[model samples]
Target: MLLSLPNWIIHLSSALEWGIAAALLFHYGKITGRRDIRLFGLAMLPHWSGSFFVLGYHISGDTIPILLDMSELINLFGSTALLLATLNLLKSTKKTSATSYTAALAAIMIAGKPQSYLGADIFDAILQLSSVVYITFLVLLLKVWRRDRTIFSGLTVAGFWFVLIFISVTIFCMYLATVVRGYPTLSHDDLLHGLAESLLSISNLMIAIGAHRKIREYKREQLNAIQG
Candidate 1:
């Protein structure tokens, strides 16, 4: 594997953290009796699965470009799933047609992207489309927060959006690695690669911690109610 032991640990931790976050969110839904939230947690699975494809690509020493492409494609679907799940939550609060809104936003987001054979350009387009979907999901999340903060803590919502920071930093680090340091890829530079990936771990940790706190608070509230 091209990744060092520490780098593998970072990657593994990120995937595990995301899984924990999803599980916590699902548990939160179970306790609160919110099917939409549960669906949201389930929607996170595709992204988690995509992460494994990433690990597989790394394990192949980045030789299997197809694995990376599959990861991107799966991530695009994951982003769409997340967006739809959030829209379902919003539907409970507003009478708006979630399907219609999702369709329109998806159309707009996908219209300009150049479709081509499965290669760098195609993968990049998929990444861009996924980013748009995720951003839309974040916007809807904020709206959901406005309607109901009890479903998720503010920190949890913030953590979801904080992924943008990880993306931005990773891009910058890739530039530094390839362009500045003359490394062929970010993975070629262990220190900078680990630094960039660690941001993902931090963001995932925030998400898990926030969900756990909310779960604890919800249980306490339930206890007080029962006692009273």
Candidate 2:
């Protein structure tokens, strides 16, 4: 019963956190008037939309593969959307390189087989490697905020690092349990995936905080200009 509680919460909150993230990013985009941010917000919806199918998949058992495949598709789409959003924020030739790499990885993930288990699969590997893109996005955002001397830069950076840690630990646990231990069960991967889902809530919360920080900074800048 104890072990089941967090799993239930994580499963349910996966959709909730994603919905909240969408709302926050949409609000942030509107406030900042950034098209890229708005697109990112739009991308968030499909990420968690698979939760419905996941719940059904569990209830109906593994007889159906479509639901599982849907989840993988959603994951690929969300990541691709994030990559596009990140590239949109930049005005450099590097954007093309980033686009190529991100598109290639996303294509690979999309073309991968559905992995319902913790075993080695192209899908799982692509998902793990996609973390590099996420980390890069956060780092670039942090640099932008740093240059602007935004009050939220430090907190944003902290949040980014926390996400990195969470993903790394989750991946390590997955490998240790599945590959090293030679266990056939998905016990470890399931637990870590749940934990990662919860961490996503924290990550989105950080974004909301950054949105508020942006507002505060804008006000300060306006006041200083008026005073001058």
Candidate 3:
């Protein structure tokens, strides 16, 4: 269903998705005014804006090295933001430290800038692998704490799994591109990419919904405390 879409439509859908997600995150952050939430929302901003780069490449049909470079840079920043957000989440649990996150960041930082298809694929693979560990741990935490009874606990666990799937799919795509010709298509129309995008957007929305419920509960508690 996704691969057949026209170029304009694909990127348009991407814009709609990441745009809505960013807005939700940002609004929630403003309401809570928590530093972690604020940073998480801020991290979402670039992923939304970065869709334009995908659109630019599609509409223009020009694979400029600079354009790809810029998009990759934006992607790196988003990854960093993701790492930070995960670290923030871990603060409450204290199950892990920032050591792995730091190592991932360092790996990305020390790596050479991706200038070719293979280079880009390798760089992205590393990023995905780095995130997979933290995300997996989060999933396990949710499973273990399943009895906590938070409204969001289920959704958050499922969302993290979905995110893991998307990242794994992305890594697989990189592998296929390495071995397959006409990979990702010169036109960039791809079923795997489309599926990954859809899954990611859905996962974000699901997590956002769960987070909103948590906020509502927090507000209710605060109001009740004030009354009591």
Candidate 4:
């Protein structure tokens, strides 16, 4: 394996936490009778599958480029799914301006990618596009929270945004490990790699815990209403 045991644990735990968060959100939607929320939960599965592709890449000692490519492709779909689901959640409200803002932001972000579209490879372009979509999703997620705080806990929303932090740190560590330290890849420098990945674990943990809290709160409200 390309990763150490501790790194493996971090990856596995991040995936597990994401899966649990999705399941909890699904259940919360079911109990609360919110179809949009259920769809949002379902939307998370593509990214979870993408994570497994990443794990497979690592398991192969990072030799399989195809696995990494597939991960990026699937993640793009995942980001789109999340964005659409969030828009659905806002269907009852007027968010034309907000949606327009996100659209313009997405365009700007995509245009602002480091390289020109003609110069970048397909996968690189896909990754950039996915980042833009994910950022748009994050922005809309905050809008959803402001519109309906009852839909998701503040912590849950924060966890989703925390992924940006993980990405930034990973990029910096990759430069330090590969460029500065002459390592082949960030994963080759276990310490920095682990440090960057641990942030992902923390974010996933927050998502799961926040979703669980929301579920419990909803269940309690139902129980109290029934008892009363």
Whole-structure CA lDDT of model 1: 0.90
On TM-score, the stronger of 2 and 4 is 4
lDDT of 1 by residue, 1-228 (tens): 789999999999999999999999999999899998899899989999999999999999999999999999999999999988998898987657677777778676567453532345778878877887888888888888888888888888989989999999999999999999999999999999999999999999999999999999999999999999
Q: Which residue runs of candidate 3 sit more than 4 Å off their true CA positions?
A: 1-10, 92-157, 170-196, 219-228
TM-score of each: 0.93, 0.61, 0.61, 0.92
Displacement of the residue 113 alpha carbon in candidate 4, Å: 8.7
Clashes of 2: 0
Residue pairs clashing, model 2: none
Cα lDDT listed for each candidate:
0.90, 0.59, 0.58, 0.89
Better of 1 and 3 by lDDT: 1
Candidate 2 lDDT over 129-173, as tens digits, reads 445455555655564445444323365446546767666666676
Give me the displacement of residue 214 in model 2, in angstroms.
Answer: 3.4
- Show model 4 residue runs off by greater than 4 Å: 94-115
Candidate with the greatest TM-score versus the true structure: 1
Clashing pairs in 1: none
For candidate 4, write residues 22-68 as lDDT tens digits: 99999999999989889999999999999999999999999998999
The sequence of per-residue lDDT tens digits that candidate 3 reaches over residues 1-228 is: 223464345447657756665565566666666565566667667656666776666555555545655666676566656556656655645556656655755565456333322434665654444454445445434633453343234664576467677667766765665557456443353655565566666776666666666667768987999999
Model 3 alpha-carbon miss at residue 209, Å:
2.8
Worst 10 residues of 1 by lDDT: 111-120
Best first by TM-score, ranked? 1, 4, 2, 3
